[model samples]
Target: MIPPAFDYHAPQTLEEALSLLDEYGDDAKILSGGHSLIPMMKLRLAQPEHIVDINALTELEYIREENGVIYIGGLTREVALEESDIIHARLPLVSEVLPLIADPQVRNLATIGGNLAHGDPGNDHPAVMLALGATIVAQGPEGKRSIHINDFFEDFYMTALEPEEILTEIQIPVPPQGSGGSYKKLERKVGDYAVAGVAAQVTVDGSGACTSAGLALTNVHYIPFKVTDGEDVLVGSKLDKEAIEKAAGIASEQCDPSNDLRGSVEYKRAMVLELTRRALRDAANQARG
Candidate 1:
């Protein structure tokens, strides 16, 4: 299948890209790494009248730390995140999960902004971003604004981004002392979307009581499911078997999986429970250490 004919514009600067978006409005689609948009275009699931290519906007391609937050450019590739020393040291969960997303070839061309902006429930970064309490920055004709991860994802293939807005960066706060995180995913095979995946981040006090916790699931709902009920279960206690089990149960209860080739609804729900438990345990252990 071939994509519909469209006008193409490669903008070298952010302002140039924004101007194109302003002109095209909803008729245009931003092309980042082209992993998601190109596929949808080819399948005719998306038929934009214009394609605004921002790959040449080098200003949006960086990874840096500022004021206790790690800022990743919208065009930053998954492979870059996987290999970033800053990410490995400050956000191990990102380094751990990047490899689990598709394969090396896909990661090489996939941008974190594209993955999140596409609003696919199967994408790995949304759940991890939720678990890390990240924020996204978007720029438009009006100006730049920030959207929290909790509010950014609205539905399947839907987000808070206006048609003319472009996501510019992702911001992740540095984890607190004694903080640790883990991502556990169950896929049909390597390089496949997760059947069920869980990302957990735990911060424990010196006495081992959880101070803050985040739990999120992927590929099991219309949006990346943030397990607030499950996170509440861990926040005031040690992540023991009983607490973990209860949290897992709560998380599993929130799942509404469809019967797909990867799994039956029941099977995916079960995997969610198991992965939640394992992720929580590993995160708790790391937090304690």
Candidate 2:
């Protein structure tokens, strides 16, 4: 199917893009990598009267680390993140999950901003971002402001981003010295969306007790589900098998999966339990090291 006819504007500068967004308001859709919007457009699921293409705004396609935080431009591609040594060293969970997103071709063209802004529950980055306690920066006519990951995602295919705002960057604080992160996903096959997925980040003190933990689940709810109860179970503990099991159980109980081609609700919930256990264990091991 073909997308509906629309006016196209390709802006070379961030200010121009913002101006376009301000002018068009909800009638326009920002085109970053085109992976998410193109498909929706073709399917007629989205029929914007104007398409604001920001690909030429090269300033929004960078990855930099400073002030104990990593800042990734909204237009940064998945392939770039996969190859970034800075990302691997500071945020291994991102590197580990990039390959699991889609095929190599899709990853090459997909932008992290597009993936998160699409607000798809099945997208891998949201859960990882939640687990990492990331923040999103958005710019609009008013000015730039930050939104925490916990508050950014509001519902299915929805976010806190106003129609006139554009997401500019993602910020992740550097984990503490003893921190470790891991992602575990179960898909129908390679290049498929996760049937169930879990991302875990753990920080352990010198005595091997968990100082902090973050856990999130994917493809099982309208929004990425942050498992705070599960995280609470791990903190102040040595992350022994019993603690892991209890955390996993709490995560499983929090999931609200619907029956889909990936699997039945029961099966996906079970996968969440199993994957959470494995992810927590691996993250704990890395933290202990």
**Per-residue CA lDDT of candidate 1, range 23-106, in tens?**
999999999899888888899999999999998987888999988999999999999998899999999888889999999999
Over 1-289, each residue of candidate 2 has an lDDT whose tens digit, in order, gives 7889999999988999999999999999999889889889999999999999988987888899999999999999999999999999999999899999998999888899999999999999999999999999999999999999999999888999998888999999999899999999998899888999999999999999999999999899989999999999999999999999999999998889999889898998899999999999999999988
For candidate 1, what is the lDDT?
Answer: 0.93
Q: TM-score per candidate, in order?
A: 0.99, 0.98
Output the lDDT of residue 11, model 1: 89
Give the Cα error of residue 128 in candidate 2, in Å. Answer: 0.4
lDDT, candidate 2, at 235? 95
Candidate 2, 190: how far from true, in Å? 1.2
Model 2 bad stretches (over 4 Å): none
